[model samples]
Target: MNEESNSKGIAMDLLQHFEDILESDPLIDELGFIHPSQFDLLNEESGISCNSFDEANCQSTDKILSEQSSKQENVYFWNKDHKLGISTHILLPLYKDAKHSFLTALKRYKTCSNQSNKDGDCLPASSSCDLESLLMRHSRSLLLLSCDFMTAWNSRKLVVSKKKQHSMFLNELILSGLVLSYSPKSEQAWNHRRWVIKSISAISSNLKDILEKESELVEKIAERSKMNYRAWNHRCWLISYMTREQVIDELKKSRSWAELHVADNCCFHYRSQLMLKIMKDSSCLVETVSFSHMVDIDKAWKDELDWNGTLIKRYVGREALWLYRRFISSCWINHFLTDSGDASHHFKESITNYHDFGTFLKKELCLIDYCSTVVDNEFGDFEAQAMHSASYLLWLKVKVPKPLENELLEKMRVIELKTLVEKSYPERSSLFNYFMS
Candidate 1:
């Protein structure tokens, strides 16, 4: 044989010898893993003879297969002292199995550093597919593989590979605690998982994607908890990572859904807080429909606000009152600005006429006040604090404008007087007085 062919044959014989040793070792029956480094020592020291094999040209699948089957018998032998060995000729099938074994082994091996080494199996169907597409298709599966039981313990510990560590940590956490467990028993695996999730850097785009996924996870958590407070708390924390505007919009939608389904005052109290958060964040950002729907909740609710001790009673009332207060505050300010400038004519058509502020406030404002007081008395909760603050500021601003002050004060007095009369008179009788006043 040529000298090159002779060297290759020797390499193949040494590989076969390492495999034979693994098969003969009694540990393979129980542990199911063999250290690669141990295989390296057998290659250097065994001095096995070979007639036909090439170490550099690992092109013959038949040869690789013959070698693999011969070595398969010795799977559990360990030679930790030998430097890690690079296999010369690997059969495709055996290579895949070895990758899986390595992944499994690394899970048990603490501090395995070369996680990407096992990823050779995860490459494309052929040589043409790029790395990005390969990862996209197999990220989750590969992540699971890398974090398999006992794999981390057996593999070379990699401290420098941040990306691999991230994958490992994520998989560990997900399988540990983020998922619903049938057994109420907590595991160290779960605590470690949470640590990894928390340690994820906020600046990373991948972390952002994970944060989005976390919303779905929180929803799942809520399902497991039956809409419990702990689930809601986690949901809120996840939402906090998103933009304020988006978070509030999502919260508003969630609150509406919550109000529709949840009948407890405490739950409604939570919804009210969510609404109040949106208003406090930026009242102007609130949509007209959400705004109008809130203020006119009874109108939206069709007198459901008056029902006896319903959770909706208190929450709807508070929301309506808050909306009314905010609407008037906005209106008063707009009108005061118009009256101060050349734009005073805009109100001549709407204000003095009962169609604008006069009749609207007479009916709506009274209802809002009654509901506000009902919320205070029944649930002892107040959502009008922001609106109240806005109104207080507006009140101070309009003190110097006599016409604006007089008009708003008169409207306020009428609302109060009508509310008092409603408490004393029959419903229809109060309606007649409300229409007359």
Candidate 2:
């Protein structure tokens, strides 16, 4: 019983200490869990005894604050500058403390709510605010330990919704972001951020800045953690809140990152989402769009097509680039070809009528033929390249206007498409045959 009591005391003390550290330094943006031995080694190297922080707890507040400021200059215990490090030794204890405190507060809040409902009168304003503050504080630590704690998350939503303060909503963003600092892929954390954004949007006019920062956060997180779908998904979701100019700027800004990471489809998917937003905005315009604006949007689409082709050739065998092309091409056909008015077709061959469509088909066929005949090395990247090209052409044939199908098939007949596909990807031959028939 003594050991259990000591453990509970230590755990709560650690949890309280962590909370204090956060309160003192709210700028802590990154979190890492280091083994306790590492903390000991750092302390030993610095000629400070271990357990110094524990001892400082009993000191006068002034002394503890002075020591904390002093400690900030060193690599630091618990926190340094903009990052927080937690020792593995205390994680279990801290988690238990946090979970216990959270559940206790949550139970109390719910019971009070039930009583208020039963009595048909609201709780006193002071009492309600106190319970909410208690619940929020406890849940913050609990979620840091276990991000998927659904009830804890839902409780926060309940509290934040009732208060509806803009600053409180932003605090929710910070809390969710902290959870993301450790767990970049936490669906609940990401969802909480989206909820906060939506709840705050009704009263917040500075959403453009918020959306920009959210996008930057995703990119920063993505840099550290590769291929994070949730991060990219969050970025894509920000598109809905962006203006048309912001959407275009994002597309241009991602160009360099996309070039550096030819294989990461998430960034490309983000680009595609931006492009789709542009298309949707153009289609749903409240007034007639200017000819110059239409030309600018058209140039943007053509530029994307050209850029994708460059990457395909430069980074051969990249299926992601090829898949992105499929989406872009289909959108081009649907928007520029079938949906364009007669005037659009007349300007610089811009509307891309059947004539411009024919030019596109020829360019694509030339591309596939060139890819299929590429010289190879032992890596067989060329083989994969040929496979992608064959499949892409075959896929494109089906997606083309029905009148062009026979023309595409006739053009393909001269290229030995079956033999080209069979050499690298025989499984898709049946698909080709299906399309051919």
Candidate 3:
């Protein structure tokens, strides 16, 4: 009984501290406020005291006064900005109130949870309902202050389960989104949102609509903060539920976004994931007399390669674009240009009119030549960006199969490329020599 009374008294004291701080603005101002006239008065006092001293003492007094005057000027300048002190006034009340409320709710929830765990039986329905309401209210309040509060989130989960409030999962989705609005990178909040969505998927029939809106939400968040891997990851998760056509639509929509953010490797990585999904969809492989679906997929792949080439040409010295090129090239070789006799007939037919393996090799070499020329002209010899471009070309020369007609010339070009890079970037000469050998 005394512990309960003591807890209530502590809560009240915390609340009173909040009120006192909120009302102490005038006191804070009085303590901080200084006037120009005060400096004059201090100087006058120093002068008067110096008059009663010897010559040496008077010099020391003057020096001390000058230092004191400088300090006063600095303080006065700092205090002139009113908003500087207002943050403490605003945050003190919020922290005190949030701490008090969070502790109180946590104590009650822990007690209820402990009792249920010990008894191995659920609480009475009415008690469970009341506790659920309490937990929901306080947890929401606490999460608004600190979105990553895992303990509060777990307690709310317990309450929802005890009360069988599965319907509340939708509301939890809304709440999680609200939390994410302020703390977009909060892993705990994002994880909770995923759990809420999964729960709703099991119970609700409108999951398609929910997931579509979720995809839009994630896109908006990604736009606001470029290179947000978490938002991109969530969008990738949404693709599993979407149809092949829907996934393709999303891919086309994100093309411009990815192009604009060429340095963001996450966007490129997400695009690769989407393409993999499309490639794996058996429904997309159904043939038509005039045009096979594989033809359309091939066209998409070609367009992506063209787009990547354009970006690489436009933005010289971007490792991300080079990395994306490698991804596209690897996917192309594995899916369309496989030398294995076991390759699918549909895949071979799709690339019949499109560039064959040799043509693709020539096109990639031409791109490398273009990048090297641009890097040379824009960023002179020995630039690190040039080294990056050279390294990528060297990697391609080794990884890609040589063309039939000019294999010797291609090998000579590779040797020249390595020699030029070795001369320009002597630091990496050893690695370049290893590649050459």
Identify the candidate with maximal TM-score: 2
- Tell me how far the alpha carbon of residue 46 in candidate 1 is from the true structure, in angstroms, after superposition: 56
Q: Identify the superior model by lDDT, candidate 2 or candidate 3.
A: 2
Which order, best to worst by TM-score? 2, 3, 1
CA-lDDT, candidates in order: 0.38, 0.79, 0.62
lDDT of 2 at 199: 90
Q: In model 1, what is the error at residue 366, expressed in angstroms?
A: 4.4
Best by lDDT: 2
All candidates: TM-score = 0.32, 0.86, 0.68
Candidate 3 residue 295 C-alpha distance from true site, Å: 1.7
Q: After superposition, how far is residue 427 of candidate 1 from its true place, in Å?
A: 23
Which clashing pairs does model 2 show? none
After superposing candidate 1 on the true structure, give the runs of residues whose Cα lies further than 4 Å from its correct spot. Answer: 1-164, 176-197, 206-209, 220-227, 252-256, 262-366, 369-409, 415-437
Model 3, residue 163: C-alpha shift (Å): 6.4
Model 2: per-residue Cα lDDT over 1-437, one tens digit each: 66567657756777787777777777778777776447656556656554454432111121122123332222223565567777664577788889999999999999999988898646787988788888998998889889999999999999889878998998888888988999999999999999999898888766887888898899888988899999999899888888998998899889999999888999999999999899788766614676567778888888998999989989989999999999999988777766444233344254443236666777788888888875866767888899889888878877988876777777777688888878757776666667777
